[model samples]
Target: MLTTEIREAFLPYCLPDITDEEVNEVVQSLKSGWLAKGPRTIEFEKKFAEYVGAEHAVAMNSCTAALHIALLSANIGPGDEVITTPMTFAASANTIIHVGAVPVFADIDPETGCIDPDEIAKKVTPRTKAIIPVHYSGHSCDLDAIYEIADKHGLFVSEDAAHAIYTRYKGRMIGDNPKGAVSYSFYATKNLSTGEGGMLVTNNEEIANRARVLITHGMSRNAWNRYAKGGSWKYDIEEPGYKYNMFDIQASLGLIQLDRLEEMQQRRAQIADRYNRAFSELAAVKVPTVSEGTTTHSWHLYVLRVNPAELRIDRDQLIEELKERNVGTSVHFIPVHLMTAYSKKFGYKKGDFPNAEAWFENIVSLPLYPSMTDDDVDYVISSVQDIVHKFGK
Candidate 1:
C-alpha cells in the first residue's frame, strides 16, 4: 500500500506542455475568423514539411485519417494486403481495413517492440500492396531491412510514425523519402500536438496532390478556398473522399508547438536519461534500448518491462500500486490481436504473436512528458523503487 504523503504528491502519466504562446496563437486564430483550413493550415504544412525534411505535407484531422488517405492515394483497396505489427495501436491496422484491405500481422522484435523485418518478409505475398512500419515508442524500426524487402517485392512503404516525430534512421528523417508516405499524429499526448490532428508527408508530388484532394471531400479545392480571393464556388467532386481536413484553429496550436519542439524534446530526453540511470541497476526492470546508427528518438513513451518471475507482483498489480501511490501510469498499448474486435474478426489466438503477447504481459508505461518537473520525476522514480523493493522476490 502507498503512504498518504506519496499519494498526495503523485504525478500524472502524461501532460501536454502547452504554454502561453500556444494560448495566444489560438486566440489570434479565433480573431482572424479564417479558422478553417486556410492560411494557417497551409503555413503549418509548409513548416512541417521543412521540419520533417519531406517534400510535401498534408494536414488532417487525425493520424488515422492521414494513414487512411496515404493508403487510398496508393490505390490500395479490397483484396489488397498490408503488413504491419500487432504490437501497435489498432489504428495502424484498422486504417488498412478502412480501405477494404486486409491487415496481415507481423511479429515484433522482442527487444524494441518494433515489427521484425524478417517477419514482415515472411508475410509478403502477391497481394501485399504496402508495408506499414510502426516506429514503436519513437524507436526507429529496422528500416534498412524493411525497405530492402519492399524494394525486392516492389511494394510501397507507408510508415505509421505516430510516435516518431523526432526519430531518425541512418541520418535521414523517417519520412524523407517519397517512395513511401509517413503519417504523424498530433494527438494531445504526442510529441508535436495540435490537440487532435495529423499530417501525411511524402516526397512524391503526385501522391501529395492526390492526398490533398482526397482529404477535402475529393473536391478540386478546399472549402476554405471555395469562398476565398480568386477562388470560384464551382467545383467538381472527382472521387468520394472523407471529411478529414484540419482546421486553422488546430494549426494555430501546431505552429506554436513546432516552435518549441526542440526545447520540449530536450526536456523529454533529459527525463528519459534520468529514468534510465535510476532503473538500469534494477534486475526486475528492463529499460528501452536504442540501436546503433539511430539518432533523435522522440522519447514519446518510456515503457518499462518488469520481470514477473523476479517480482512477486504482476504488471497489473504494479499499475495498481502506482495508482495507489497517486503516480498515474498507462499501458503503451494492448496488442491489437488481443482486443475482442481484432480477435474475433481475424480469429486471432492468444499465442498468435509470441513476442508481442509476451511483451504486453510485462510492460508498463511510466509518466513521461516534457512538462514533468524534476520533483515529479523524482517522485515517480521513488514510487517505482518503493514498489519494486517491497514486491521483488
Candidate 2:
C-alpha cells in the first residue's frame, strides 16, 4: 500500500527529452539559410538509414505521408485491399484509403494488442495487395508469422513502425530486412523526437527511388539540387505528387535525437523496469509483456491493462482517479475502427472487433517518457497502486 500523499504537480503522459544539443542543432540549421530539404535533411536520412541497418531512408513531413507514399509506390490503389489492425492510430488505415485502397481491419492479439497473423490470414482475398502491421506501442508484431502469411499470399508488407524506433524482431531491427517498406515516426511524442517528421526505410532500391520522387511533387530532382549552384533551372514533373518533403530544420533535430537515442532509450527502459516490478504484484493490473529473448521492446508507452472484474471501478474511473491525483494518463488509441470516420465508412460497430473493443476499454498509457525523473516514476507507480488498492473489489 502506498502511503505517500497525492503529487502536488501534474505529470503528463509523455514529454520529449530535448536538451541543448537538439536546440543547438536546430539553430545551426536555421542559420544555414537553406532550410527546406537541404544538407541536414540529407544527412539525417543517411544517418537514420545506417542506424536501422536499412539500405535507404527517405525523410518525410509525417509518418502519415510515409505510409501514403509507401503504399502509392507499391501500386496499392483502387481495387486493392490493405490489411491492418484497428487497434492503432487512424493514420495506419487512413493512408490505405488515401491511396484509393480499402482498409481491412484484422483483430489483434489480446495480450500484446498486435494484429493476429491468424486474423490477417482470414482477411486475405483476391484483391488483397499489402499488409501494414503497426508495431503497436513499440512492441514488434510477430514478424515470423506476419511474414510467413505475406509470403504465402505473395503480398507486400509495409510496416507502420511509428512506435518502434529501437524495437527488434527475431534479433533484427524492424526495417533491416528487404521484405518491405517500413515507416518510422519522429513526432513530438515518439521514442525518437524531431518535433514533426518521419522516415520511410526499405532495402528495395526501386521503392526508395520512387518514394523520393513522390515526396517532392514527383519532380525529377529535389529542391536543394535544383536551386544549388551549377543547377539547371529546367525540371520535369514525373507524376502528380504531394508536398511531403521533410525540412532541414526538422532533420537537424532528428540527427541529434538519433545520436542521443540509445541514452534516452536506456532511461525509458529503466523507468519501464521500475513500473513492471512495482505493478507485477497488483492483481488488478497487467503490465505489458515482451517476447523474452527473441525481441526488444522500445518501451515507448507503458500501457497497463486493468482487470475490470477485480476492481470496484472501471478503466475510465481509474484514469479519472489518476488524473485527480495529478498523474496524466491516455489511451494509446480508441481503436481506429470505432472512430467516426472509419466506423461510418467501413460500417463497423462496437462488437465488430471484440478483442480490440475489450482491450480498448481497459488499457491506459502511463507517463513513461525519458525526461521523467525517478520521483516522477515513483509518483505514477504509487498513485496507480493506491488507486487499485482503494478500488479493488
Candidate 1 stretches with Cα past 4 Å from truth are 1-4
Poorest stretch of ten by lDDT in candidate 1: 1-10
Among residues 3 or more apart in sequence or in different chains, the pairs in candidate 1 whose N, CA or C atoms overlap within 3 Å are none
lDDT of 2 by residue, 1-393 (tens): 557697788899988989999999889889999778889999999999999999999999999999999999998999899999999999999999999899999999999998989999999999999999989999999888998999999999999999999998888887886589999998999999888989999999999999999998888876567878877788799999889999989999999999999999899999999999999999999999776423788998889999877888999999999999999999988988888988788798889899999999999999999889999998888898899888898
Backbone clashes for every candidate come to 0, 0
Off by over 4 Å in 2: 292-294
- Deviation in angstroms for 215 in model 2? 0.6
Clashing pairs in 2: none
> Can you write out model 1's per-residue Cα lDDT over 216-314, one digit (the tens) per residue?
889887667878778888888989988999999999999999999999999999999999999987888888988864687889999999987788999
RMSD in Å for model 2: 1.1
